[model samples]
Target: MNPAMNESSHTPPLVEISGLCKWFGEFSALYDINLQVNSGERVVVCGPSGSGKSTMIRCINQLEEHQAGTIKVDGREVMPGMKQIEEVRRDVGMVFQSFNLFPHLTVVENLTIGPIRNKLVSKTEATERAMHYLERVHIAEQADKYPPQLSGGQQQRVAIARSLCLQPKIMLFDEPTSALDPEMIAGVLDVMIELAEGGMTMICVTHEMGFARRVADRIVFMDFGEIVEVAEPETFFNSPRTERAKLFLSQLLGH
Candidate 1:
């Protein structure tokens, strides 16, 4: 077994963060945050609105720069202005809460843009990969339609398909279902659960405990800009160690 495996016997984390902190002028958004996501792991981070969950995930891909600490992806330390950042970005795909689809483009076009722009594939190949993921997300039939023509759930699914066309090794979902209607949330989550079962490494910042319970290997609890607890889903929900986590679970799970 690799010595770096942290109990599950998997290899070292595909993503690792240590002593990460982010600041905006006088305000601090993150502090002393540390986390790791082993390959094929699904980690769900849940917490209050200001808990820095989104910022932490954003830093993993350099979407948000951290003032202090180190983030390494695939064993290479993330550095600013380095060509390695592009490689890291290519290996990691992110799906935001808002669909972020191009309104002027058809779903197929939207999905092909990243691969085509990066010259990762020829136009024909990108389109083929786009359709494959669209089918996987159950929306291949809508490939010719523009973003506005799709339902909220369908748009979010398209967003997921767009990310998949990149053939990334890891996926980051920042509150992917937050902008959807209650009815739409489940559809998006269902696709995510399928993605998880397929053994894709995923780090999600979402408040949906049910989804966490269903698909997450571990749940990370953050509060006031710091990680408060990290536990397996069953232990996290049933036996949280911190009052902040308990209160958060109660508030979220409370009717």
Candidate 2:
């Protein structure tokens, strides 16, 4: 077993994407993307700009429609216009590059919206749950403040707390730290590391190699919409097989 995924187990896949293809008009954004994330595994997807790392994760939750192939969440195939998509999405939590919190709502209110609307949680109950996650993220004091009133790191913490309120089975992060300033990145990654240590099944699209090596069970590299390589972090960073992957890692680690 690779040291990166010391506790990695061969359980059934929680999220499976096979032969997945996506396009924007005439341009293909993903080409035959395939991946499977097992329960309690944390996979980090890395690539250069325009490499479709974000698009691939988006397809897992149907945020971006795919043109071909299958995405199964917890054994149910995800199909557009299918009623099960809502049910599947309810169990999947996503955090985007931007902290998409409602600026007008207080931090706690932002966290409560999804559970109250979809989970049928009582306002009082939702607030309590929100506070729990906020505390977990080390930002309970910011709960009553509005998104705009907090720093970038604080707002992103609120976003994470909001997702946790939904109690998702799988968490997807699309460049969650990319938008933050250098100093603020550590705070978000710290929370993500905590989540990983707690055995959360997670897939993150990020360039943060330190986080990938320290917390990821596997590192998946993509280029030109193709999954170039997938391996445990030690092998991937130290001895990538594919030239594309080696070049990509050299560029990243050499900096």
Candidate 3:
């Protein structure tokens, strides 16, 4: 019945990280990292190579474990060796730079396997879900083709559809366009932009400033294993608050 207590009872963020730290032998990949992503928020992470941008998001899905930190997804605590880790993973979908599709499987099969095997959905239902997502990505016509048969962009679209099959609450993209040819990048970005417009919560690690400006609600700049600045896209690109960010933007946009 206290006024201050009532005021502080706001909803928690959809994904929350606190005091996150990671080490590879003696090298600290991430240090004292903290971040929170809310429902339907699109966050873009940008930084130079080896700045721990990828490592930080990987920790969110537990692809790589952190030695110390607290990660909570949907208000459930996520820690190393937790039995509920699989549940956490199911809610967090990730697309890597590489397509990572099954070489021998058809596109439809690749999309359905996770739901059929993991969620125990019937084959009919899984295929229906697969086709729906494939259609959403504009690759339904290629659903019967193998990964080897599709162009790089089509293959990446399949990869995105595969993740969507799970109907995850959050999507993590680890440089989704970096592995594609320059001509192939636009297709993938188009699919991503469409997903953003549909209000999917997304955390992307990319150097594509154009995409960031167009899609991101906030831009997170990291350097030397630490977050250098966090700001709105307009502020981050036009008038960054930190010296590191200013220099980074200058070098990145210098051409």
Q: Give the winner by lDDT.
A: 3
lDDT of each residue in 1-255, candidate 2, tens digit only: 323245445445788899999999999999998899887789999989899999999888898889899999887898767776877888899998889999988999999999998866898999899899999999998887889899898888888888889999899999999999999999999999999998888999999999999999899999999999999999998889999998887888786
Tens-digit lDDT track of model 3 for 1-255: 222223334867788999999999999999999899887889999998899999999998888999998989988988888888887888999999998999899999999998988965899999999999999999999989899999889999999999999999899999999999999999999999999988888999999999999999999999999988999999999999999999999999999
Clashing residue pairs, backbone N/CA/C < 3 A, model 2: none
C-alpha lDDT of all candidate models, in order = 0.90, 0.89, 0.91
- TM-score of candidate 1 against the unseen true structure: 0.94
TM-score of 3: 0.95
Q: After superposition, how far is residue 159 of candidate 3 from its true place, in Å?
A: 0.6
- TM-score winner between 2 and 3, please give it: 3
Q: List the residue pairs that clash in candidate 3.
A: none
Q: Report the C-alpha displacement of residue 22, candidate 3, in angstroms.
A: 0.3
Cα TM-score per model? 0.94, 0.94, 0.95
For residues 1-255, what per-residue lDDT tens digits would candidate 1 score against the true structure? 322344545456799899998997888999999888888888999999988999899888898888899999988888556666877898899999988999999999999999999999999999999999999999999999999999999999999999899988899999999999999998899999999888888999998888999999899999989999999999999989999999998998899
Q: How far off is residue 215 in model 1, in Å?
A: 1.0
